[model samples]
Target: MKFTHTIKAAALVGIAGTVALMSGCAMSQSGDLNGMKGGGHEYLLTVTRPNQLHVIDTETNKIVRSCDVPGTFGQGTVEPSPDGRIAYVGTNKWEDVVGFDITNCDIVFSAKQSYDNVTVKSFVSLAVSRDGKELYTVQNPTRKLNDRYEVMEPQLAVYDTSAGLNAKPIRTFPVDRQITKIMAMDTGEVILAGNDVQAINPENGDIRILTLLQNWKRGDSWTQPDAFAMHTLGEQADEFILPYFTIKWNGDPGDMEKAEFWWGMSRVDLKTGEVEQGEILPFEFIVFNFITDPTDSNILYGAFNTLSKHDIREKKTLAVHNMEHTYYDLNMTQNRTIYVGGTSSDISIHDPDTLEKIGSIKLPGDQSTSAMRIAFLK
Candidate 1:
């Protein structure tokens, strides 16, 4: 079985004048979408400002379905089920999580991380186990009792996906503050990325620090690493690739170059909890997110105001291309074609070898913002 573009749905969500005619087929069992092979529907799921989710067909470059997600405040990240059938998003002002059945364009699961009495916020990244049995996210919570509010410790919240909508966190384990990303490893362990990476046992909630960023030794004045890309790369399915930048402040206010900062990535091994890094370089530009070519780990691609391809071996940017607008997410095709989106209405596609803009897909609507991350389903 291989990934294909087959739109087989047992159910379909009908929105008046929106989401055009989709076949009214019986919905497939909510299972591992990554397992389904042959011709199946492949989509680029994007979430916009004020809680709107647009599902665009990657092949057709058209909006096949769009839905206004209720209760979602700021734009959050979208994580797809293993089968790619459902997209789970952390919304409702990053205080709630919802699972939307992309085929039907309806929510199938919802969990609120925060409430009036208990305020909680998930930092926009969610992880689903490869088995699709558990969902994990770092929850920052606060409890309000009487007139005073208690800031509770952040915890790793786990939900059983099979529990369906309204699935409450079955278990929560204490996690460190400033945790930016959560990833379910191939070994039934969850990786929490922040100041340092940690591997946690899903069954017993035991956590161990996998690696430290300071080991790279760029400088002592480095800031916390912001790992925006949580998904594992294809080449290193058992590893997590985190691209982050560190800022430094020098006494010379006029010397901007001295304070230019540095950027690099930490390639973490999920099973053994090991980490490795390449050369570190100055922050030439702003990169909100980045991805490495699984086929060629030496080549790293970054996205923001410009799309850049840096050769880790060479320790310099191989090429840079101006984008129509800044991007928040970056991914590549099987053959290495690049897909950059998240900031404006469309996704920009570029050649992997040359970093040349070959094509672009303009999404439906005016001023639509792509979700924090884009899911490319085969």
Candidate 2:
């Protein structure tokens, strides 16, 4: 339980820039994104402020490419294409979405579409479905609702990318009701969670509710109002949850016990709108993205914003990666762990299984990008 802030300035990047995995040698510089994959892996990363995207070779953990986004990152969202060949970013900079071909490291398309009303404020969230046919962006941006505090509720806009580049959103809705997680079923039913599996048909604005638990406990039983957060997962059956993971002070239960929180990670079923059956994490986790076990409902993996794992059958949290502000996104397969999108100018590395800080990652510049959208190219 000790804290040290010795390293100062951008030079910190050089420290964690060295990475060595079971696959090969690791070395990465700034403007590079290293995605996790089997054998050989790489990622084209986009970051906020000073606007740019970096391509990192996972095998070498080194930057192979860096591209300028002009004045974009603050307002645009970047998402990888279905095939992993292209990166798509949508920005309010104008009324268009820019598509970058990662293989060549350049912009290929600037698809333009018109909207009657525009906030013009850049805060955004990007999401790509399992099949990559449906793309979603938070039109209102993920900001603090309290203007005085930085909280906000952004609208979810669904787009049909399977069609033309200018294809429009087939659905748009807010997630605040009984729903805690919202994702597409690819079957025209939107998944939501809360007291039940709620589905909203964007076309007619009709409602469908599926009960996940007959004797469901109220949200207040385990969650606080301010702890509001949500996400969508698993297209096969459509699953979601209201996240309730956080650090609890070490002490005996009772008045002496104290707990403070800032995040939660939950997933819901798009088909049933019911929160899929699963055990809640023993501790709270604040992750931007989490992957569900494609085969089982209990096995779940996500970044606690510091790397984490959980087992539904045992109802336990596997202590892995003691990353302090170094978690971003996660990808899971069978029993493999793949993490991506992290920022901490200084070097930060931990065991993928224990989460112990094995070392740190130092970036080349202070220009660290916060990933707004991401996905494994399957």
Candidate 3:
């Protein structure tokens, strides 16, 4: 079940014209010196159908700007620059990277990964450097031959953010397969999640597994861990955390019913490059993504069919509130207001302590698995 958008020539021309007109208006507004000041407000960045990047002010829970992003909307994986001025999104059926100036909706940087006979697609693997000077993506390529498709090796492509309009990878290195998410750490390492959690140095391409998921070893009684994370929301907690489920035998090794299903969390500290893993829950439930509280690292929140809060250190569920709909991604503001998004147009807000529904911000179209990211404007 791949999400894609068909491109048409007439629609492309119309979109280009609309962007040009918007750029003119932006320039006119920029000329007013009184309009250029910082409010130090926080905004949520998300993309919706038909190629639109929506920015909502967390304070007002209103759509402040809807930027025109070139290319067809696919995964809509977005990563805001460190300064929060530019937003880079995965679009064009997941084959291109487009960066938009959120203030004016101008296409500042563009990179098409697919060309010629090889079709390259990036599945939710996007990140930006701490200094906002570099961008990273894991490109999975396949060659279309006359007979069949040849699967090629995946590569981690790095791009200079200053490369305007038409951009290409300044450097690319071979990476492991099945990578769905990549995040830049303050320690200058990019953490990748796939079969296993890995940290790769962008400078020399030195890669190492920070934590094992598929290749985990917990004696012969425990089964291999199964985990998947697609959304990038760990910036608030400053740690990339992934939840995994595994089975451990409680009684007889050959007994089927005596198996204990366990849920665990694997965390990588973005600040110190430290790795840790431990059991969070003794049972399993549906949880698409989890976010840790920046002020309280022991507290974590998860989103799916229900919103849940957990105290990982104490190994207890603090709260669980059933949601009206499924939300694939979860994020939090500096003040601890919870926001769950993805799989729909509306981002539901909740109280962090009680998991009570407080407010919601509705977009113009369905998010369709787009990543929900928080950006602070100072």
Candidate 4:
């Protein structure tokens, strides 16, 4: 039977109410079920305002559990362990990293980045190793003096995940400024996105530029590309992809009216350690974030005020669906269902083929720049 939009909305409300009522139940009940081996379920992980880490079961479109996280929430960036058991979050106003055991909602690991009169902040930079043994974040510190504020050089802080509670950086290395995203590759190399896409050796602090983004010499007709790397949604596709924008002079370089805006993507393969980037499409609309299809690398989905599907090789957009509001993050499950969340409490789900909104998962409060990530539980 075909259900109307009104009917589906009503049914979703009913399910949400039931889940809310079940919220008071013991955590162990759901923990035991999620802890079972070979469960093979995909769960959505995100944080909402007022300090909450929500785990939504994708199959039922219901939030199974909302765990309480320590410290205040700010730029809520969550990095789930490779095993999907622990979630490392950047909270406490971006001054600390806290790892929560999703199975029991226990605070397993915590690292305070700031100490003394020096204030440190990691803006959306958090990543866990594939083996789940090491956690990495780039910390920008500023020392407040009696009369002046001194800005210190940024450093990459590495923490051992097993260092439960009050974890400190086991090793620190200097890195470039403006790095907002970090990802651990299978080869034990860490990738940083900022002024340029760079790969750094975590063991020795050696760094090499994989792609020249802001400093790219794409001829005199093209301006410097601008891109921001905030969301970590590469796990599903096993590749870290970032979209960038640049303007090209159509005719005379001195003429401003003939400028053509373009959008491109810089990608790093997590498995093969290969780096490649190129223009995907001429700018038609704005996209806050993008996620590549797990099954097909050529296909891409973008989210913001609209949901768009694109073919990178063809440099064409296959479909575009206008959204009700803006979303800052985009992710997909193994089944290819696209999930868009940010700037609101609800996570909107869409059909991969039609690009149509199929369902929505309502959260407890506003997401407020939080990252929405997918994790598989087994």
Give each model a TM-score.
0.79, 0.57, 0.89, 0.90
lDDT of 4 by residue, 330-360 (tens): 8989999889889998989999999999999
Cα lDDT of candidate 3 equals: 0.84
Please count the clashing residue pairs in each candidate, in the order shown.
Answer: 16, 50, 0, 0
* Two-way lDDT contest, 2 vs 3, winner: 3
Cα shift from native, residue 34, model 4 (Å): 5.1
Error of 1 at 155 (Å): 0.7
- Candidate 3's C-alpha runs over 4 A off are 1-40, 253-256
| Range of the 10 consecutive residues with the lowest summed lDDT in candidate 2 | 20-29
What is the C-alpha lDDT profile of model 2 across 213-323, one tens digit per residue? 423453433332232333233322234444444333344323235543323344555554444443355545455555656666665566645666667567666655555
- Indicate which candidate wins on lDDT: 4
TM-score, model 3 to reference: 0.89
What's the ranking of the predictions by TM-score, best on top? 4, 3, 1, 2
Q: What's the lDDT of the predicted structure labeled candidate 1?
A: 0.68
For candidate 3, write residues 175-281 as lDDT tens digits: 99999888898888899999999999999899998988888777778888888677776877767888888788877765769988878888888889899887787
lDDT tens per residue, model 1, 1-378: 123322222133224212321221124443334333314445667777667677766555566677777785544567776666667877777788877767666666678777668988877558888777788888899898998989999998889875555578899888888786677767788877777777889788898877676444545555555544444333223457777676665745445666756687777765565677643556788877667776876778888889888878777888888887777777765456677876676778889888889888776543333343334443
Better of 1 and 4 by lDDT: 4
Clashes of 4: 0
